[model samples]
Target: MGKIVGSAIVSHHPGLMQCEDFRRMMGAGQDSDLIAGYERLRHKIEAVKPDVVVIFDSHWFTTGYHLVDGGAHYEGVYTSDEMPWYLYGVPYNYRGHPAFALDIEAVSKEMGGYNRAIAHSGLERQYATLNLIKHLRFELSDTPVVSASSCQNCRPEHFLQSGAVIGEAIRRSDLNVVLLASGALSHRFVDIDWKPNHPRIFHESNLSSPENLASDKKAIALMQDGRHDRILEDWDSDFRKAHWEAFGAHYLQMLGAMGGAECRAKGEPLSAYENARGTGNIHVWFDA
Candidate 1:
């Protein structure tokens, strides 16, 4: 049986990687606390020493079926199309595990999650995985990695089932695996015209509104109390706004892969941030 040593939900905004440049662009205070939280996660990762790190990216939208990054050599120069000004010409080099990509595809097919392969050069990984890799010490050659796509037409149920298949694939393999759910909690944004030194934005960011804060707090509490089922049940409609990122599918994958019923929140906050647009960033660790 395969072993799962670590699992977490993280924010992969390009701003996280280019905090200084982002601050220069947005004219916001330095986010020292948010940096500390991610640093803590980095420490935990080193302790885990996983053989493979599987990333579930929110920005990677596949239409018909789930997709996996199947390229064995992941070396590329990344320039974010969304925010090229902040993250331009960033070099990312890593090793990929193509064999396990096929393994996950087979297991996903068995679990009714048809999987596709994205095996080629010139395809840039989304910031969700790239930002985290930039901060953490896990390199491609040191520890091979793979990425899973978030199907645009999928529901929370579909994501959960796909996550189960991924977990099963990890179990049948000999590698020690760690999982990452990379996305934002509340992803709504305001107008992009906000200049530097805006009063509404700061280190300890206030949530967009009280309702957004409450919704995010409740979501985190549910995770802390080991209420994975409630997340699966109320996510699509409740505990979230219509604009929340990935429809909370990122958390569903983390919850499902770690151990569906057995997964529980450790009441430990990994990282939390509210961007200028009122998007809530959360990083939580789930016990397998």
Candidate 2:
């Protein structure tokens, strides 16, 4: 079966978006660096060295719990003058589930408890998942990296079943190294008022006002306490305000796969990339 190899994460502020180069090289340029953040993301992905990568984007989801069947097959995205990255056999696809099915109780059970687990796991309430497809390389012999699709949204209990499904996929792959989760700490910013359906990228001055101390402190406290409800509330409130790039469900699922163990953030916080947006791009590592 495949095993997690390594993982890399950075704040996805449109300003700091880092994977554009890879995307462009692969002919996925419909994307815009309207935010410089994409460029940095590519470096992060490269560092992970994943044969196949699963990305959980919060921007695309229904209100209820939902998981995209990443292993499902699809025709390669080729047309006109474009050649398929893999013109012969099968194309790569994503397989991890999103975090909608995971709730506070389920999270607690997975981690032990709010206080004990948070202190032990060193997890910030904010996080995301990036399971490496290479981990499932063995399974590839039976089920090559063909593509398919479906979305499922269920309760926490049902979510566990979903996790089992994903885990099974990994175990079958027979991969050596599996890239795990990576994401930010929180998203409250000073003077950043916002709304939904707003642009993903924006100007810096509109976001960098220094009035977000209260919210930030509150978030830190909730995280320290392992209060998922409060953490969710504060995050959603602030998220609506600045409305910059974010991937909450993505980070949460990554942390879930880590067995809720103690994790220490490894890098400096990069908060000024996308219009002075604050993201938990802090690098982290943990023991299994």
Candidate 3:
């Protein structure tokens, strides 16, 4: 039977794509911890030897239903329309696990969830998934990947339901898998004009507000303590109000697959919580 060997909440902020020298300049002469964190996270993943990595892409938003890329393979040069100049002409080539994706769709149908697997190769790619692949240095021939989209209209529960379906699907398949929640904590961006005053954009002081910073730290603490139950309980009342990226669906879904509020996987910090354009970002690994 297939099983999830590990999982992580990782930062995929565009700043990580910049050249090392450029990243150092932005980090006040130090490299973003996320850079080194990727290496650490990759080593952990290697230890588990997963055959496929499933990414819950916070940036690939769908409206009516949850979506998963089931394409056979993907090969292309990508340029982020959101920030073309910064992430232009990037080459990417990777295999996709179509059978496993279809299995997820099948399980979703059985569970009365709204999830679909799109096998068309033309499906657009998002940085949330691509960035991790690049930073983790996954050899294209070794491990295939599948990208799942977050439904924009769904609440925290919906994401959890979708994740449950994915977990069932994984159990029915034969491929060992790793789950990645590719997004940030507090996602409120600073005003365009604010950069002039906050030149060191990556510094924690540049986070959108003190409240966002505190909220992110609180969530991090809960994760470290394996208190996902508390985080879920407060989703609507507090954490949601902090404006987590993609409504925090990436994390909700990943946790859902791991048994939702029942999961007690402790998080190991791979990167220090930091700021990216006023949003909170970090990398934390959870052994499943």
Candidate 4:
């Protein structure tokens, strides 16, 4: 089998490529800053130059657990640019142009059995898989790529199961595997009120104010004080209470991918920022 190696995690926040602070973090270059975080990540990937690249994003799917084998020939459901979903919803465009879309409903139906992590609703297995396709279509446009074959009906017991699927794919293919898990750390929507004992409210809000660079500093202080674990366990309700679910699916996905059976959790925050809207965008990664 080809060497099973090289993994990465890239933030999908539109602000990542747009913000000056983020660029500064990236410019840190191998020392004393968040960019060095990615430098270590790159070295890990280089050590295992995987050929079969599997990029998984927690935000992609809508319903069920899904997987897209990039090497397979599969039919995808397309939603046009004129579709209502794009008008008032989060519009995903690639390279300055609109793109074809896939339906998560199909994938969810294809993959039976679901998990209800949150009390009200959560991403179904099918939706997650379909979202991956849409994300890949937009992120990797302008390339000659085969369509993705959807994987359904698998309820991952834990994050390890997710990695096992990728590992199995690598064992089956002639190419080395590059696994990408995309998600953020402690960010929440504008409406989310983390309700820390002493809330250090920054100017206006962190979501929409691009000028408010100090909020991230506050977040770091909160983190340094060892308040992050509470955020992790209570994030589902506390963070989601603000109007959106903290996308921890990617965290779980990465755990499942990297750990498999012998996986233990070791984590670090790579980058953190709040948009003009006060929504926090923090990139975190874990190792097993």
Best by lDDT: 3
Candidate 2 lDDT score relative to the true structure: 0.33
- Per-candidate RMSD vs. true structure? 2.5, 12.2, 1.3, 10.7
Worst 10 residues of 4 by lDDT: 96-105
| Candidate 2 wrong stretches, greater than 4 Å | 8-37, 63-65, 71-172, 176-205, 208-247, 265-272, 276-288
| lDDT ranking, high to low | 3, 1, 4, 2
Candidate 1 backbone collisions, by pair = 2-171, 95-140
Query: lDDT tens digits, residues 42-159, model 1?
Result: 8787788888898888888889887889998877778888898878887888888999898988887677766666797877688878887877756733777788888889777677
**Model 2 per-residue lDDT tens digits across residues 1-288:** 564444333343322223556434422343333223323434444455544544433333433333332323322321111122322232333332222112322533454432110111221111122112322332342222211111134333332333344433444554433333333334544434553222433332233343343344444444445453444445446633433233344444443343322333232222222332433233332222
Worst-scoring 10-residue span by lDDT in model 3: 194-203
Predictions in order: lDDT = 0.74, 0.33, 0.91, 0.38
TM-scores for all candidates: the values are 0.90, 0.41, 0.97, 0.45
Clashes of 2: 57
Better of 1 and 2 by lDDT: 1
Given candidate 3, what's the lDDT at residue 116?
Answer: 96
User: Top TM-score: which candidate number?
Assistant: 3
lDDT tens digits by residue: candidate 3, 77-106:
889999998898988888888888899999
The C-alpha stretches of model 3 lying farther than 4 A from their native spots are 195-200
Q: Global CA lDDT of candidate 1, please?
A: 0.74
